[model samples]
Target: MAYPRKPLFAPNGAVATSQPLAAAAGLAVLRRGGNAVDAALATAVALTVLQPPSNDIGGDLFAIVWDGERLHGLTAAGRSPAALTREMVLAATGRRAAEPVAALGGAQARGPAMPARGWLPVTVPGAPAGWHDLHDRFGSLPFADLFTDAIGYAEHGHPVSTGTAIGWARAVAGHAGLVGAEFAEFERVFTVGGRAPRPGERWRNPDAARTLRRIAETGADDFYRGRIAEALDAHAARTGGLISGDDLARHTSTWVDPVSARYRGHEVWELPPPGQGIAALLALNILDGWDPAGADPVERLHRQVEAVKLGFADAHAHVADPERAPVPTAALLDPAYAAARRALLTERAGDPVAGDPERGGTVYLCTADAGGMMVSLIQSTYLAFGSHVVLPGHGFALQNRGTGFRLDPDHPNVVGPAKRPFHTIIPGFLTRDGAPVGPFGVMGGHMQPQGHVQLLAGMLDAGLDPQAALDAPRWYWHAGRTLLVEPELAARPGLVAGLRARGHEVAVAAEPSVFGYGQALWRGAAGWVGGSESRIDGAAVGY
Candidate 1:
């Protein structure tokens, strides 16, 4: 069922994103003499308008930027509202106490848990600040110009894509029973005639356009300290929400050095703690001990899944905000630690346990410019439609990132005031011998790093082209020893049987989105080559 597609080549620039329009928006910026950072910021803003179910202006953002000479990492994830506390959250959920994932053997939390969508799970959105900071550091074009396409689409309307339509319906269905006043604005802003828009239907949001204009004009100050913050505070006071103007004003995105692990002959890079980018690095570290270059398909997959399980186990155990608690980043990425973890991966899939390292959603996009600058960026609202708490006048939803917090009091990521919770969205980049290769990323909740591991193996080890690597059948280690594979992968001549023989609870998934969608850009001798995700409506446009 593979489609005939080749990587697009461009001498000057390239942009890839989940939506065709978003990619085009970035390309337009490149054509306007904007650098890769400008193109990336343009695309990121447009996605908030074009793909509302996946991301919005009211979300978290992380990025790895190659500004020609070196790499820069930005983590714009927001902290919990100062008004919120662990005691209040526990009381709200009616849970006397909570159990850690270690106690549950990495099973999805059962019993009382944080609400998936509500004012309770909402946190300070850091994307607006992220956009501002990235531009201040790397942009070559006027900041206001980046919002032109996004604002135009928001005001004039654009046809919804198939994948977005499906997600829109699912989100509406998921929140159908929420009739609270806090949820009313969401229904009004996102729906037409009380329902999600169908594919190709024109969707407009004048309010969102206005808000984007304010951010563009004020350089995002409006979002954190001006009118937008006042409006959000007023809404929170009226509703039973926790966020306040102080929380918004105090939010600041951090710039950190990118963490990396050498894989094959290249170095894979991601942002550090509090975000799960380390999980991909951890998995890669363990995987580096053995060369799966020409191994059997089953054996390669088994090792990949096993490494991922161990990575997630440790990530879930230790990854928390370093500002709040200690995160042994160096210890976790140590070569010796990886060797010790690799030894545990036997012929059989064993229950993964924490080895004292650490842990760590959303949309992913990559843009490359003729100047050799590349940007890998990811942003998200946590879940489909986020907390489903759209701002009344602004017409955007806030992220439910607080849900990533553990309810266990002893956990490093426990819910607390002004502390960032665990983040799922991560952007990745590749380099060899200190030279830039390209920027790449996958977008899904926990499937992000898993996608990173699988995608890299295909491109680097098997020598598949970027498109082929993305098109290849995928697998996800859901929880425990259970493994979810696409129907195509299951049909791969005894692939399922082989995995099951290794004590894996193999389940063939019906939906392809469960494996996530990704985009990649590779720097070749000829030019910049790019690949776009085929599982959804997307494009890789260059010139």
Candidate 2:
């Protein structure tokens, strides 16, 4: 189904998000004389309450901000518990940390990485700090003022939108049988009457309201060093969790430099390491080598898919916590190296190996204020309902970001104490000629970078508008030689067959959610132009 173009244009401010209410929350902040950072912070906080299945107060955050003069990057991701170690995890799970499993013929390799859910994978959350720090740096409104809408929604309840309802049901189904104590709090807080809420159903979480209020009033200190930390400590003690008060106190959101790749005269910017954003940059680097302007439709997609494969292969091999491991970000994005990597691409789908130069959730929301400040932000709990270990009486779950750590001792991403993991959620921005274009991002685990490439290609390469860029069908590169495309993209004339002829495996996606939900804001002559996801219950509001 082709979505019709109905872009929102506003003279003063614009906000876009995966949930409509969240978008409205940001817009309201802007109307209240807040800057772009404040509006984005409001939207992000509102998403925690409105889209619990995707994000929460327990999640991590990353953002790229254009604060009139230049761009700024924020990495609010948390680290592994200070007490956690590979040996401890192995012992807890009945595996030998120093020995290899019998199935693999290695003498000294560990077993698989940590499980997807439970206390072992829970990391100290950085979102509260993220909110406070972003505001401290670039925000105009009072920090407490930003929480008004989120607290109201949590206390008084709001109708569940279709997208949130669908994700909520799926998360409930996924965790149906794990009746352990670690998951009990999640079940209690999220499920009402032993089931997920239906669309348009009013759902309330007064506990979350109380928590947000405290965080706001206390400037988020309680979450890291005070009452909320005490509660988290007690809960961890009762549930055999590893996070402690010290771990919570040690967590901080960092202000880092943003990285960029030049694509067709425009520079696409993303947050630096500890994120897979570099993958999007690498893929764009490869795509830049080709004149996609006059390329065949099928051929254009083929190159795009192949480029992403190469990008992911290298990113998986080398993109880790740079503070813990060496990541060759500069060498990888070098034009000469990108050209060398591009040399591997052919008419057929080929599995490209990682080059030596190497390396490089998850709400995505963007806001633009009349002051010319633009912000691109993304926050997530890693997976749905995160570790399934909700803070008792808090009505929020902890993120399972520890699962991103590889178990192998020789790997760059090996699990260890006080180290950040390879993160999936990233925020993106675009600019040309040293001036800001606007903020943009796509929210879905691995589909994020892929969506970035496709979005930019549609706009910069194909001359499509923001709405058309988002409304276009998407394709996800699943694995080696395999591609999962939307039904609409598959239905394109000769597209699937053409891809198959090039030694690619093409399957129409079983669900549309895998393609991701995206948001974008572009500066127009009259004001800011915004586009939101058509596949999800999202909106791009302007005022």
Candidate 3:
């Protein structure tokens, strides 16, 4: 069944998001003589307020941009505190920790976790610094202007979209103990009776508004080196947390050339190694070698699945911070190596097995303004509510992304001082003949690469529109050996068996699968075609 919503096409500028208000906010910025970078920054700031459960100012941000002539990537992902070490955490808890989510689950099972107290889970928040850096480098409008829409939404209130409401409700229920006085205060301002506010229900966040106003009045320094930093450090000090004023002062976003590879004449660009954007690139590279033009539908699906499995094997084995990771980038993406890896996919699927390679939220936006500038940006708190740490005066939560690091010293992504962990959040862009073609992203921890593969196959190989490609059925193989196929795709019974025959140990998803919340802006002959996933309650707007 097709979703009933009119598609938006604009010749000059457009924005697509999981919420219509956000799209409108970006479009408004574009109309106000802002470039794509400005529009995206506005929309991103707005999302932090409107989609609080999935994102916050205390999270991490990653982006890819088309700045006229070349593509650029911003890796503003947060890092573990310099004081944080595996030994320290193990010593504090008197046990070796699993993933952060695992620790959260354990805490839930027994009682409230330390993170609920708003101190222990704090990390060096990168979003604020990242936003400032982007504006300083490429934005056309005043940095203060970007916070206006976000501040208004937080203070005066905005309708809660269906997708956001559902996600919020789930987060609240899952991490009930994390709900402290600060969260309770937010409930009083935003929710009705400690429950999710329905779609069209008005919700406000006065605390967040106050926080934004502070940043606007004092500038980014207030966040990194001034009062805000002091407040964050104080909270961590009182709790068992590790962040320091030095960490805040030292935090800065990195600007680097976008990493990319050619796939079927289209160039796919993503952030480099420290992030897992290469997983998507590697998958596309493997698929590019396949004959999508002549292969049967089932055969195409089989090859795509095989390619992803192989790509992920490499990702798990080697991808990490380039400074620390042992595997060379050239070796991993080498054509000869890819051919050798592709050989592992037999005509028949392998046995039902978990891919033991690497370990693993979120808003995605794509904006293009009248200046011909484009940006694909993503930000998140890792899991919903992050470490569930809501700083008191900062009006933001912090990310638990440090949980992705391993305690095993031998692991490529093992936690260390000044090292970026293997990140799941990645933004993507596509170009053809050296010109930007589209800005898109698939957001879900491990499912990101899989989502990218499907999106590329649909748009480039099958010639489907952006929305149709996103609307198409999707699947994901969890690290736990479960093959969570979406209900729509499950309807095709033999397909599962076909994959099973090839040796995949598959099972139907207990809920909707972790495919991705995709958003994109495709450059077509007509103009810009903006598309947002129907699975998410969002829209694409253009002018």
Whose lDDT is greatest here?
1
Q: What lDDT score is found at residue 348 in candidate 1?
A: 96
Instruction: Give the whole-model CA lDDT for all candidates, comma-separated.
Output: 0.88, 0.87, 0.75
Q: Using lDDT, rank the candidates from best to worst.
A: 1, 2, 3
Instruction: Give per-model TM-scores.
Output: 0.96, 0.96, 0.91
lDDT of 3 by residue, 314-365 (tens): 6655666676666567776777877776666678663222233221268889
Scanning candidate 1 in windows of ten residues, the lowest lDDT window is 352-361
Tens digits of lDDT, candidate 1, 1-543: 545567888888999999999999999999999999999999999999999989998999999999999999999999999988878987787755443422211443422446778899899999999999999999999999999999999999999999899988988887888868789899889999889999999999999999999999999999999999999999999988999999999999999999999999899999998998889998999999998757898899999998988888878778889989998888999999999989989999887643221111367899999989999999999888889999998989998888888666767887888999888898999999999999999888888889999999999988988888998889977666878899888888989999999999999897877889999999988789889999998799999
Q: Which regions of candidate 2 are displaced past 4 Å?
A: 1-3, 100-111, 352-361
Tell me the RMSD of model 1 versus the true structure: 2.5
Give me the displacement of residue 101 in model 1, in angstroms. Answer: 9.3
Question: Which stretches of candidate 1 lie above 4 Å from their native place?
Answer: 97-112, 353-361
Candidate 2, 377-462: lDDT as tens digits: 99999888888889989989999988877777777777899999888888999999889999999888778888999999999988
Cα miss at 60, model 2 (Å)? 0.5
Q: What is the lDDT of residue 134 in candidate 2?
A: 96
lDDT head-to-head 1 vs 3, winner: 1
Reference-based lDDT, residue 342, model 3: 68
